[model samples]
Target chain A: MLAEREEQLEALLVEREVEQFLYYEAELLDNRELHEWFDHVADDINYRMPRRLMRENTASVFSERGYYFNEDYGSLKARVERFDSEYAWAERPPTRTRRYVTNVRVTRDDEALAEDELFVEANLLVYLSRGDSEKHTFFSARREDVLRRRGDTFEIADREIRLDQTVLSTDNISIFL
Target chain B: MAAGDKPSVTEQALQDARDSLDEGFFPLEFFHDENLHDLEMERIFGQAWVFIGHESEIPEPGDYARRYIGDDAFIFVRDESGEVNLLFDSCRHRGAQVCRAEQGNTSHFRCPYHGWTYKNDGDAAGIPQKSKAFKNLDREEYGLAHVPRLETYEGLVFASLAEEGPSFEEWLGDFKWYFDVHMKLPEGGMEVIGEPHRWVIDANWKTIADNFNGDSYHTAWAHGSVLDLELGGEETVGHAGTGDSLDRHIHCDGHTTSMRGFEDEDVFLTYPEGVVEDLFTKEDLSDAQWKLARQALSFTGAIFPNFGFLHFGDTTDDPEKDVAPFFTIRKWRPLGPDKMELWSWGLAPKNAPEEFKERMYKMYTSNFGPTGNFEQDDVPIWKGITESANGQFASSQNLQLNYQMGLEWMSEMELDDEWLGPGFAYSENLEEGGMRLFHEQWYEMLAGNDRTDATGTPMNVQEDQ
Candidate 1:
């Protein structure tokens, strides 16, 4: 009985650690510290956001051939660095965003993950306002991530963002989800 | 502003617009005027040959996808006999939508409201009540209405709402000569990659039309991030009139295409050796068309009213990756004066290797889509222009947005006497004549005249004479 109680406490601590890391990452993105956020990305990160499909019978169907983003480390880095140019007018004024990360779940026993890696799923809601107007929008998505333990913290090794809207309502997806 | 001399609000606005166009300018207020939007829907879109979808989207029998043309919904379907049809989405019974899904395969569409069933080819198959309730009703006369005119060219489908207008052939005219180079270059032709990328934005449709109509001047400044990151070479994304590349803006049959190529070189739009040697054929093209394809590096063009395309080479998503080519076509659908839906599709040669086709699609999303590195900056700027034109300041000040970059007084632009295609080619890319051409067509259509009334001999030719 004591040994089982100890296992439960260890799991709780690990979940808390993961929740803190996610909150910190959200703070970095909200602050627009892209370079700093990039520091937490693993060298072999595979980031993707597949396009959603609406059907009569199925509630959730993603297109096998269509996607909004499929980025390797090099390309994602290029996208991150692009905002530094003054001519990148999409973010010249900088979009203000608030990220609400919730419903975090961590799987430590998945056979597909290594001993040092954890599979995490979370619900994300990002509220964005741009161009000094009352105009605002929200991006609600479900994110599946692979987080690798790197010394004291964690790094995002893989992430798949499934956006909820099939037809985006924003002028452009200038900000990362 | 005299009351006796006053025209209706619309007539006055159109008159001001015409005066501005004659002076190589366009009024800023027309971008978001509600009255003008209504007239545009009644005039331009109602009569124009609007792009619907490519044929490949529904290749199998019973395949169908929902499509739109100026707020009208349609089911682009292929029937059991392998014939394609565009049927109105509304049910004949009570005007309820019969197609529930965005895309699917179905032998027949049964309306949920009253169980009115339509065959994939739009023939009314059955009524639930049948002879018991309404024996006098003729099912033959109740099939869903098709668009007034539906036509296809090289697998690309277009539709017109008006029963009377220029035939599709007459509408395209000499522009087909230029488009043929794109559609006929590869063996087995090009096919759309997947579903199109769709996004709604707050912008006027004309804003993007002007950009696609050869606004080469904006490439260096607006997309500088792509240059700064070395994702694209300078020649493909460089300052106009600065590189040694042969740059020409060609206008034909009320359409425009801007090209960048090397002189007498086998660039072939920088397609890799495998594609160039195996897939490209000279069988369907003339010597001149083959030569144009051989020397081309990039091509951007637009059909009148709403369609645009970009076929580019020497670009990559990552600087470390080898450059590849991407071809994309798009249409801007007007929702309101300040809102439009942008639908864009990526395409590749149908016979190319599977891996290469996937890579081409990757390049397209990385460069041109809603999340593209180059296009992310373009949408917001267009939205801002629409916003600026929404207020009273522009119309009150009589603001005239200048399109005079290539006019006689602005620059001594000349025509290319040795052009090999079926259009008037400007020798230099530093010109805004294409935008002026687009505006002239827009004005002609809105004025209840044939759009071709704006087409004539090139002004540079007249100037030279």
Candidate 2:
């Protein structure tokens, strides 16, 4: 006999549902559908990338002055606009990128967060193949996001990226990580 | 290709720079030459008060951050007693880089090369093979070699390679008012908000400095094409940034200074005359608020060396950082002659109301940093300038930036009493004059009380200040 609970936390936030959203977001970003991608974030979302520093093994760069990018939603849109325009020469040729966001952690019952806040962290790997450079270089980081859920949709209110690279070799951070 | 034939650009370029003491701006050659680049790093970058890192970066007792001055790597950290220290990020024992990463909180930094250890204060705490490496090495004396001097004002960290000079306060001089107004206004001094958005641009560090110091002229052309904003297009920022005009001034020891107001008919001339009267359809602001907004005046200037701050309120709040319009402090650290790593921060109004802080950060992030709204457009231009100036013809890259706005102070308006503040007054039009004033200080610091060459032909006009 199967007993159905009134509201099971697991069912409310199933792994398939969360992973589906994650993968879909990544595809939209990779494809440069910026407006569609922004729909997934909360209006007051905070996006930040703490710098990754070179330090002793026991120290975590996440805690120090290590930051790469810290921005909000409007700033994120402006960045996309730069790439979207011919004026944004950094990506005028439009550098293609593949983003992989893994290890999505869903904290449904986190007491520390506000009612609207949904916590998730994703480990991302970005591979960019630009111009004639044959040797490939990659970037990886762990993202801590405080996603806000409004009714049926979702938004990002705060996000922080902890990068693993002390010395960034990327041509430009025109793309959102 | 011969010195006498067409003349090697290297010789001709140096000759022109030596001869053209009147113009403060130099040729692109100074930025790209490998030998001169090396000398700049050793002398200018090495000896000057190179901005290291912000003090807020190392808030905790064991917090630390890494920085780059030219190719050099230095670390800034907070000790147990909470004092900021700058040290070469190298292990003294074996020369392995101690702080190999950008920043982190650490009780002790142990080198991976050979397990050498150092306390947060840069003291040699231990060595794995202590009794084996040598007979004896004093750990205290052998710890990290600190930058010559570590100093902080308004929460920004600055280090000088020279052990002696005017105090950072004195060197900063009257510029303290600028810093005090913006930086000191913030409650906890100011937090970096996040890591600095860093990128290697392909432009001379000096050019970038000149550009930011008060080249409002480019805003209309460069960012205008990019943002579609009608900044003073033909005019640079100093004399012609439409919203306002600045009378360029300089402090003793070479700090380029200014006084600004909204007078240029060139400004807002782009807008239909009396456009506000047409805004009768839009009825939100009271008459007083609207008048004040129109009356708002601003100041943008730089300290003699590389430290400069920009204060303008084109927009009251940045929608991105959720911070209000603010004063910004930025230092162009020369990574190379033609390469610069720009460190920028937003200074909120120290006395601003709470909601104002939020608006300032948004404006700052959207427009300024690695991912700034307007910033995204600027980096590519810097790179383009550096790339175009790299070849043989690169030597002849004549950026004959002019500086003859007000040739003599006697003819210029007095800066005091009649000026907006207590500063010198020169025409807002001669924008490059500030760059000349800056370089005059640069020469003074670099050559140390002399500009005469072997032929006694003065290398620079000593009167720029």
For B436-460, candidate 2 gives per-residue lDDT tens digits of 5665544443444421112121122
Model number with the top lDDT: 1
Across B391-449, the per-residue lDDT of candidate 1 in tens digits comes to 76787787889998877788879888899998789999999888988999898888899
How many clashes (backbone N, Cα, C below 3 Å) per candidate?
0, 45
Per-residue accuracy of model 2 over A87-161 as CA lDDT, tens digit each: 555565556789988888777678879976667878999887654345345778887877776666566677788
The CA lDDT at B370 in model 1 is 90
Alpha-carbon shift of residue B96 in model 2 (angstroms): 2.8
- In order, candidate lDDTs are 0.90, 0.58
Which candidate wins on TM-score? Answer: 1
Model 2's alpha-carbon lDDT is 0.58
